[model samples]
Structures are given as C-alpha cells and as structure tokens.
Target: MAGRPTIYDVAERAGVSKSLVSLVLNRSPSVSEASRLAVEEAIAALGYRPSRAAANLAARSTRLVGVLIDDYTNLWFVDLVRGLRTTLGEHGYRVTVADMATAPPTENPVEGFLSMRVEGVVVAMDVPAALSDPAAPPVVIAGTRRAAPPDADSVTNDDAVGARLAAEHLLSLGHRRLGHLTASGGAAVVRRASFVEAVERSGATVVTIEHDGPTDEQAGFDGAIALLETHPETTAIFAANDLMALGALGAARQLRRRVPEDLSIMGYDNTPLARTRLVDLTTIDDNSFAVGIEAGRLLLDRMNDADARTGAGAGATSDGHARATHRTLEPDLILRGTTGPAPAAAP
Candidate 1:
C-alpha cells in the first residue's frame, strides 16, 4: 500500500515472523508448506521483491561466487560458465566473472572479489602468486595447473594425458617428425613435456617445440612460423590450444602445406574453433564443462563444511584446509579433418 514493500511488509501481511518469511524466500526445506504459501501470497499482494543484498544478509552469506578467467577471447570458458551456472543456480548461488586481462596489473582478481565479500572464488586462470595464500573463504582452482594456496581445491583436465593423446594420434598417423607450438602458461608446459615424452617413447625422431610470450592466436601464428622455419621437416604440429592451432593452420596455408595432405595439425582444448567447418582441427577435448561442474561442487562442499564447523561451536576450524584436494578429469581425443596420414613425402 506504500511506495515500496519490504520484508517487514511481507511478514506483516503474511501473519508470520520476518524470520519465517526469510526462510521461505531462501527456499529452506525446514519452512513448512503453509508458511511458504503464506509468504508467497503476501509477496504477490505487496509486490515485494526481495533485494539480493537483503537476502544475503538474512542468510548470513553473500551466496555469490567469483569466477576469474584468464582471457575472454578463448572460447573454452563459454562451456565452463555454462556448467558452473548449472550447478550453482540449483543452490541459489550467483556467479560474477572477471577477466584477469582487464584487471589492473598491480591488483589481482581474487583480492578484488574477496574485498566484495563473495562467498567463494574459482580461479579459472593460472594461479597468481598473489593468490598463493588465501586464508579465508573457499577457493577452487578451475582448468589450471599452477601452484595454488595450501587450502585451495583444484578441478582440471590432465593436460599431460591430453598431450600424450595428441602425440599418439599424430604418431599413429605415420607422422615421424612433429612440432609443438606452445607458450609460457602452466598448461602449455605440461602439454609440451608430455607431448615430447610420448613422441620419444614412440622411438621416433624428437619433436620440435617452440614457445611464445602469451597463449593466443597471434602467439600461435608467430610460433608456427618459427617452428616451420626451424624444423622444415616437421610432418605434423600440435598446438598448446585451439587458438594456436588455428594459427598453425594459417602458417600451413602461407607455406603452401596442405593440411593432412602435406602436414597434420592437432590442438588442445577442442574449443568451438576446432569444430568450425573452416578449421575442423583435430584436438584434445579438455572437458571444460565437466571441470566447471566439479569446481562448483567442490567449492560448495568446502563452504558447507566451513559453515558446519562454525555452527558446531568448534574452537578451531578443521585441518581440512591444510590439505589441498586436486581432481583431474580425463580429456578425449577428437579426430577431425585436420589430421590424417602423414604426407607421402613426409615433408
């Protein structure tokens, strides 16, 4: 009946305690159906929309999850976010994504999110030294392989296994001489090391690995050019990621090396670019969506445990924080048109 309706208005009209109204709004199972219905009816009658901040205060939690991504241009994060939302939404949690690329060089994304009092944080990028020692709040590392805080949980694809798969595919396709275009990221390091190991185990000639500054399409392009020049005999190439793989494709075209016909190219991440008709890159699917889902589940569990400990009148939190947990999902090898039998001449 006034300019705006608040929780007090909804509770008054519902003939229930404000705390009861809060429980119903939060979808607490303990709230009786009668009370829930009464709250709902009152909400409709008063046109009362609960503010997010208010709801958070009532729940004694922000219920906000921060997701920090390395770069937005990389399509792998699209599926990751989809999975994150699927799990987080069911539990009434909202996710706010921030790109590390856009953040101030002196300020890390995790600090900024913590300053806002987010309930949990998921670092989807490589672990920065600034976040190497998060003391409070749940922190989960997603899709990355860097040294994280002692208490941090991690959900990531086994990059070494994925690289081994790529190397196996290329070697099985009769590719004796290969090159790997990589960069300075942790994932790239693992992929490169594993790819080389797989190649060496095959008893084939050593593979040529080239690196660039950042992991991007341009880095891939430049690295490919350098690799091709230094190892002109390379019959196949594997990029650290799909973006670099696309660059390798460009290099092939410029060098007049027809894909699969003159050279085979493979990439990691199996991003949307790998599925495109023009690219059709043979790649290792890191199962980004699954990583996101696992990260969400792990973070939720951590938060719940922390809350339970706090409510139990424990003198100190559990030592669970001292022991880090890491989960690795297996990646799939997706074969596409970009890879085939090595050229007859073998470059």
Candidate 2:
C-alpha cells in the first residue's frame, strides 16, 4: 500500500540491524559515537519519524505521559499538576512525574522518561539536551523557560509583564527606592530585568541582591537582608516567588522593620503560602493552574496530530511533532497585608 517508511528500511539503509537502530533511537550509551552519527544520518536521509509505538517496538498506545519539574519542594507545581489532571484524566491518560532536583547528577531526565515509554512529555523546567533527539516524543513545556525546543509547545505566564505590574504597584505606593529579591538564573532573570526597567522608567531607584543559588526561602532571606543592609533607602521589596517573600518577611522581622510600615514587601506566584492567614502576602498571580490546563490541551492536540500522521513519512525532519506554538497568559497583582503605602520614610 506504500503507506509509510518503517524502521526496517532505515536499518537496511544504515547497514545495521533493526535492534542496533533501536539502541541508537533510545540513545543507549553503549553505542559508539560513530554509529550514533551514522544512524542519525540514515534517519534524516529517509525522513523516518519515530513515535511511541515505533520506539517501543509495538503498535499499541501507551497512554502514559511524562512530566519533569525543576523542584519538588516548591509547592507551586501542585496547582499546575492538578490543572493537567483535570483535562488529562478525562482522556484516560495518566502522568508520571520526575523532579530534576531529585534526579541523579549524572542521569538525563529526558532519557529516563523516553525509556519509560511515556507517549508524551511536559517539562516545567529547563529543556534537556536529550530532547533534541529525532526519536523523542511530542513535548509541551508548561512554564517560562529561557529556551525551549523549536518543536515544543509552550504554555506559560509572562513573567516580564508580571514584574512590570509589580513595579507599578510599588510605584503607586510612593516608593521612590525599591529592591528586588531574585536568583541568578531561571525565570528570575527575566522578571528582575523587566522589573528594573519598569521601576527605572518611572523615575524610581531600584536595587537588587541576586542569589547565586536556587531561589528558595533561604535565598530570599539572604537576598533581602543584603539588599536592605546596603540600600536602607529602599522602601519596597519584590521577591521572585512566595517562598522568597516569606524569607523576606523573616528578614524584615530580623532587621526590626515593620511590614507595610517600614518596608513594603511583594512576591510573585500566588501560591498556597501566599494565601495563608499568617503570610497574607501581596503577590502576582501567574496562574500556574491555568498554564497547566493549556499545557495539557496543547499536548493532547500534539498527540492527536502525531497519531494522525502515523501513515506518513516526516519528510527529512528529525522532530516528529508539528511546529511549536506558544501561549502566554496575563499576570494579575493580588493585594494583601504585606504591601501597603511606602513607609513615611525608609526605616
């Protein structure tokens, strides 16, 4: 019927056995680099698209989806996962999650998921090098990443917009000098940069203490302490996340600065901690749950498209998924007890 080019044809063309091709597709470390390059070249030449059924060497669907997150301790992902299950559960698909923080230092998270035979993958963290493989599954990235695959769908919040909104909120409170609590990498870089721009654009002064490590509560505490110590005139503080905001709160208490009186504090990601009666932090709602819902929807759309193309050759492309599309949701500021009018004077 001249339906599609199968792995057998690639094996014949590459002058290797079908099992060797499978090993190459799986990115087994046992294969020599030379053989890997040869197999990749053969696949490219023949436009052989590898799917879950093809990679597993079976034609049946797995109905399992892989999810990789940056950190497990950060409860922000809870809403994201719930939103994903809300849509995925109805379709009979289940998710298996892997946390990058807990993964072995030498292991590649993407390789593990591919080996697990997950039909698709959703990444809420950095894009892995292994994801560029031609045999990789359809993928959707669920949050703001600095770089995403050219073929991966992205459903994320606009951190830059949210950061600017924070600037506006603090500026309206008559804060002439401000501080940003941030980390050296991840989405914080973008948020901090945009925040500084917005604050400076409003003719206000902004200083920041950026941590060289993860943006956890410790980083937030340390950063806030440093920022305040150096820039006492800074009347307001904006943290990259709620945990950091909590840390900032601790810094305020330690330094004897009163919240919304001596220092106005704000945070990002309206997580559960932000909603707590004790925390009651003014924060940005990036809508992590909504992002998850859209991510699930995009992944299902990709899967449907991939399934529809089962009988067709991918025409010389390494990636099997369709062209990537990005969806960004607006960010909203949620006012709470932590942030108020800038101090009558910086304490």
- Give the TM-score of each candidate: 0.81, 0.80
How well is each residue in 1-347 modelled by candidate 1, as lDDT tens digits? 54567666777899986656665665656567988999899999878876654544447777799888888888878888888888887777889898977778897677888787787888887776666654546788987656766568899999999999999899989999888888887788889889999999888765555664778888888888888888888889999999888988998999998998888988999898789999998999999999989999888777655553333223324546468789999999999999999877623
Model 2: lDDT of residue 223: 94
Lowest-sum lDDT 10-residue window in model 2: 308-317
Q: Residue by residue across 18-127, what tens digits does model 2's lDDT show?
A: 55666566544556788888888888988887765444443456678888887887778888888888777766678888888888899878888888888788888777
Please give the distance, in angstroms, between residue 61's alpha carbon in candidate 1 and its true position after superposition.
2.3
TM-score of 1: 0.81
Candidates in order have lDDT scores of 0.80, 0.82
Best by lDDT: 2
